[model samples]
Target chain A: MSNIPEELHYSRSHEWIRRNEDGTVTVGITDHAQDLLGDMVYVELPEPGQRLAAGDECMVVESVKAASDVYSPLSGEVVAVNDQLADTPELVNQDPYGEGWLFTLQPAEEGEPEELMGAESYRKLIESES
Target chain B: MTLKTALYEQHLSLGGRMVDFGGWQMPLHYGSQIEEHHSVRKSAGMFDVSHMMIVDLAGERVREFMRLLLANDVGAEPRPGKAIYSCMLNEQGGVIDDLIVYDRADDGFRMVVNAATRDKDLAWIDRHARSFGVDVQARVDLAMIAAQGPEARERVMRVLGAEAPAGTETLRPFQAAWNDRLFVSRTGYTGEDGFEIILPEEEATGLWQRLHRGGLTPSGLGARDTLRLEAGMNLYGADMDENCTPLESGLAWTVAWDPADREFIGRAPLETQRSIGVTRKLKGLVLEARGVLRSGQRVECGASGEGVITSGSFSPTLGKAIALARMPSAAEGSCRVEIRGKMVDARIVKPPFVRNGKSCLQGSPTDE
Candidate 1:
């Protein structure tokens, strides 16, 4: 479950992002966030057209034990939010990488994703923790 | 090294996050706490409560011994297999530990004590037993697993299969059985209807495996804490300890002062406290803020004074943070909890933030 593919980038705030072929990018929480949060029971996501600055709290993930703020890794407008998580939040705990992806974002800055951690660096960060 | 329960190996096998709770290595959760909680409410769940010490008392004057030992009167027309919940108090009427006293039979009684206070309880009982000729034996060879919730009994029945033998589903709440091998008691920490099964230590793993196979999810100490808190049950060490009396801890009703002449260990102190009037009280608080609440956080009462949260957690059922705090009884001060270094607005209310698998708040309708 911890196999963060080499294609994605991570933020210190625990947001994982993967750039799309278009100008948009996919964003979600990392496996680390889901593990600490026990079982995710509910999620409140920002709307598709919602505007956000970098590091803005645009979403929330509520686990059985605690509720956590999901900060935006990059300045962007939400293009699409995961509709499935509204009913099945366990996917975030089950498959944090695949079906659990939160939303797509059209970056306000073209190269903002470069500031985030790459797959290699993110793996090192998580490894250092344990 | 301290002795762990029979399920220690089983919990490890199931990939349970193990933590030392009251000296026993117990599971906090199998994998997901939310699913485990939901499983109990919607279906069935099992918890290894083997850390709690089970003491079997046998002597001619066992009934008489309990009358003076507990704050709750047990000499009042008691029958076999019936149980009474009591607070074992110190000389000053402060609770030493709250425990269940079961009348196993004539001249046979058993008391279950908290694991943290096991040594204290044994010493207290042994010191007091000399006057009444009581024999106290702590049952460390046995293990206890609680199968709790609406569907818990059926799951146990399914696991037992043909070995199920007799009627356990019909066992009324708080009743116990000393059948051929198993000692099943219709009691639980979760507010739901359930049974606590006690058997030999060797048989625990097999029974646990069977229960798991029958759809009873395994829950650890973490889920157990939330479940008990949601049900408004008190944690002995946190909610109330030797420093406070039961009367001030919202447990005044559990103390029986009837017959008046019946003197218990803490009778003098309790009576003195009653006459002096209680100063501080234990109350519940539901957080209305954005941050998470935790123990040791200051709860501001007014401009002058403050309280502290003894036990706090996010209520899975209500989807809000809740806690029990020790504060002054007289209050016109609308309370607020100090969360994340900020004094956040909070509502001080009664103990139960939720009950019977339903939310019990004003203006908020029950969810499911």
Candidate 2:
């Protein structure tokens, strides 16, 4: 099972978004996703300042054994991406909620992050999946 | 249709991600595949390899039969419990299977074959043994677990404690020993020092829990593939199957053509191929990519026409993508791989890209 922090909201695709005090939503994969994929070898991130549509593939994470895309949870303008993943991708597996965070974005429409699940809801989803 | 091993219940209890590999429901990983890969490379990890079929062949002529059946001759004098790695071949010189033959005693040799090829291998052996008068018994009651990596042996031995047998102390590579009903062999898949233990299926959970308590991480097949690739070990299905000859799969060293008079199923055709030289050969490719490399991806070796990657992955130790490719015989030096519709440049490199957690490939053509 993967770790899901209680303070964050999660998308069905296994990404977590932490609404920061600065109004940007910090995005990263859930500990569950990283655990399933194994040791990450390469991480491709979105270029900051780019506008993104909800559910768009904004990044890619490649484990030594498999590769998968990181989809955006909400429509927004990309504000930041952790460039450190280029050389230390395993951070995603080791610290999915902290230093392993993928990117940050500013909401474009000031709208709700609809369809996003809270920690309890995500846990239920994981339970139902089992 | 066969029954699951003893770890079946435990796998489900631990929330293992299961996949049907070669018709067996096996754990791909518990959660993080990358962590599992690193755990073995850096610490220790264990795998459930019970799906590999084990057959014990007992007969008076076991030695002579194996000398004729396998690519590597194990008929040479050997102490009891010594194991030999060999390949079974077809009459056309193509590989039937690669197997381990354990010279358990003068009375018999035990053959461990790939799970997917169990039926065909059994049929082949039975058909060819018509005159050998051997008793072939498939051992369904046993399960196999391989503890691998630098700390694998120590962790496993710690768990076994007094159960670790004397014969295993000075056990040479591929040697086996049985003590208190547990069989331990100095063999592994990770290209690291380790041991494989075969025991009653019911006892697997006990050992698994012990190893878990001892901190031997439970890794899945996903990590196994990457580890074997880094070790330059050929995967049976990907690198070569029943349709490909060992000669073309970079396993020619396993074939013994000694005495010049001994006859084997594939000898005639293999001899012919050797004389004319193989048309296609397996080679390693290190990609200096703008993206990832994967199997079934076509490789364009400039002027050598098309080739294809059989197995490929990002090498954790090297921090780059590597692949074992089947390419034209004349192919050499450099090549390009078609990834996501792009022709990404790559270079031919010697395999064993990493061994024992150290990088073996350097100066890879990353510039192009």
- List the candidate 1 regions with Cα displacement exceeding 4 Å: A9-29, A40-130, B161-167, B288-291, B303-305, B332-334
At residue A121, candidate 1 shows an lDDT of 90
In the range A20-47, model 1's lDDT, one tens digit per residue, is 9997989888888788778776677789
lDDT of each structure? 0.83, 0.84
Instruction: Compose the digit string of candidate 2's lDDT tens values, residues B159-264.
Output: 8888887767678888998866788899887888888998988889998888988999988888888898988888888899878898899899888889677786
- Maximum-lDDT candidate: 2
lDDT of 2 by residue, A94-118 (tens): 8999999999999876755778989
Residue-by-residue lDDT tens digits, candidate 1, B189-222: 8888788898999999999998898888899888
